[model samples]
Target: MAQQERAIRTRRTILEAAGAVFDEYGYASTTISMVLERADVTKGALYFHFSSKESLAQAVLDEQVPFGAVPEQPCKLQEIIDMTFVVAQRLLTDSLLRGSVRLTVDQATPPGVDHSGPFRQWAERLIALMEQARSQGELLPTVQPRDTVELLVGGFAGIQLMSRALTDRADLAHRVSVLWSHILPSLAVPGLLLGLDSKADRGLRVLSAVPVS
Candidate 1:
């Protein structure tokens, strides 16, 4: 058990190192040597966990959908808003998340480097939130959860991409707040919509509430 736990720790260290390198250089420019140097582990140690850079890239991509610090809300739509803001906040500070977002959208990956899992996970969460909002009478009758979720996912991708390019994502939370404020009125019932927390710091407050380990 001790050995297994140590292995898990070692693997996490390596993944974080590799993610940092990926974020710095992107996939095509990233090399195993860079990750090895950053990880401070022998090549054999890296190979025991990840055989190649592509495998590491996949692992990093899989790490993107971490839903940290989102306490359940009376309004399900609030939960979704919280999720977006938290992710934006994370994108700014978390190397793994920043790496994963870039890797998932980057088209120059080696052939068959699939990032469908993260995208599907995002869709599932948004769809579930939309469904919950419907149950709580937060959504308009004309708002189809699946369709709205799909549009939201697409719009979020574009907004983050533009933000990353323009501001290195410094304005991500603000952009996301603007996005929710503009779209919520159309999709949500007026009563619930007015009560939603669409501010940029919505997720930051949730994050700040958790004690740092």
Candidate 2:
């Protein structure tokens, strides 16, 4: 059991090191030696966990899906909003997530690595919530779940990139709040909008409430 736990910790260290390197230098410039130096792990240890740089990049992208996820809300729309904000908050400090987003949007990624996985995972998750919101009458009658999901995903991607570039994401939460304010009016019902909380500090509140693990 102790050996397994140590192995798990080692893998996490390598991933985080890789994430930081990738976030700093991007996929094309990041090399195994760089990751090894950052991780302070033997070549054999890294190869045991990840066969190649492409595989490591893919793992970093894949691992992002589970980080900083908010607890489900009573209103699916609110849940969706919380989901976005929590990620926004985490991005202020989490290099793994930043690395994942950078890789997903980086046009220079190696052809062998499919960076679409995180986008699809987020789309599918949001689509399910949007469909539920529609059923619960939280969405506008004209709002199509798939289309709305696509817009939300794409809009968040753009907003996050802009925030990263402009302020290194110092104001990402505010930008995300602005995004929801504009988008919700078009997609949500009037009554639902009144009940929704799209404040800039919503992410802080949500993170504060989450139990430390």
Candidate 3:
């Protein structure tokens, strides 16, 4: 058991080190030697977990999803809003997520590495919530769940990029809140709009509300 645990820790350390390097150097310029130096792990150890640099980068890219017990809300729209805020809040400090995001947007990756997974995954998650909102009569009659989700996901990608450039994403939560304010009116029913929480600190509140595991 102890050996297994240690192996897991070693794997996490290597992945994080790779992520940090990828974040700094991007895919094309990031080499296995760079990751080894950052991780301070032997080549044998890295090869045991990841066969190649592409695989390591893909692992980091796949780690983009946020993990936690975010309390589910009765209003699916609110739940969706909270989800965005949570990501925005975490992006401020989480190096793994930051690295994943950088890889997702970087255009220099080799042809085999796909960065579209995160976007598709986010779109699918949001579409599921939007569908639930529609069933609950929370969404506007004209709002199509898939369409709204696509627009939102694309808009969010752009918003985060702008925020990253402007303030290193320090203002991302606020920008996302502003985005929801403009988008919710068009997406949600009137009654739901008034009750939804789109505040900037909502991400912090949502995360804090989760009991420590």
Give the top-scoring candidate (TM-score): 2
lDDT agreement of model 3 with the native: 0.87
lDDT of 3 by residue, 33-100 (tens): 99999899999999999999888888998888654226899998899888889888888877788888
TM-score of each: 0.94, 0.97, 0.95
After superposition on all C-alphas, the RMSD of every candidate to the true structure, in Å, is: 1.5, 0.9, 1.4
Model 2: per-residue Cα lDDT over 1-213, one tens digit each: 999999999999999999999999998899999999999999999999999999999999998778747887889999999989999999988878888888999888888888988889999988998999899999889998898888988999999999999999999999999999899999988887899999999999999988887
Local accuracy of candidate 1 as per-residue lDDT tens digits, 1-213:
999998899898898887788878888999999999998999999999997888899998878877434777888888888888888888887887888888888777787567666788889978988898898788889999998888888888899999989999999899999999889988988777677888888877978875675
Question: In model 3, where do residues sit more than 4 Å from their true spots?
Answer: 67-69
Q: Compute the lDDT for candidate 1.
A: 0.85
Which TM-score value belongs to model 3? 0.95
| Candidate 2's TM-score | 0.97
| Candidates arranged by TM-score, highest first | 2, 3, 1
Give model 1 RMSD, 1 decimal. 1.5
Clashes of each: 0, 0, 0
The predicted structure with the larger lDDT, 1 or 2, is: 2
Could you tell me the TM-score of candidate 1? 0.94
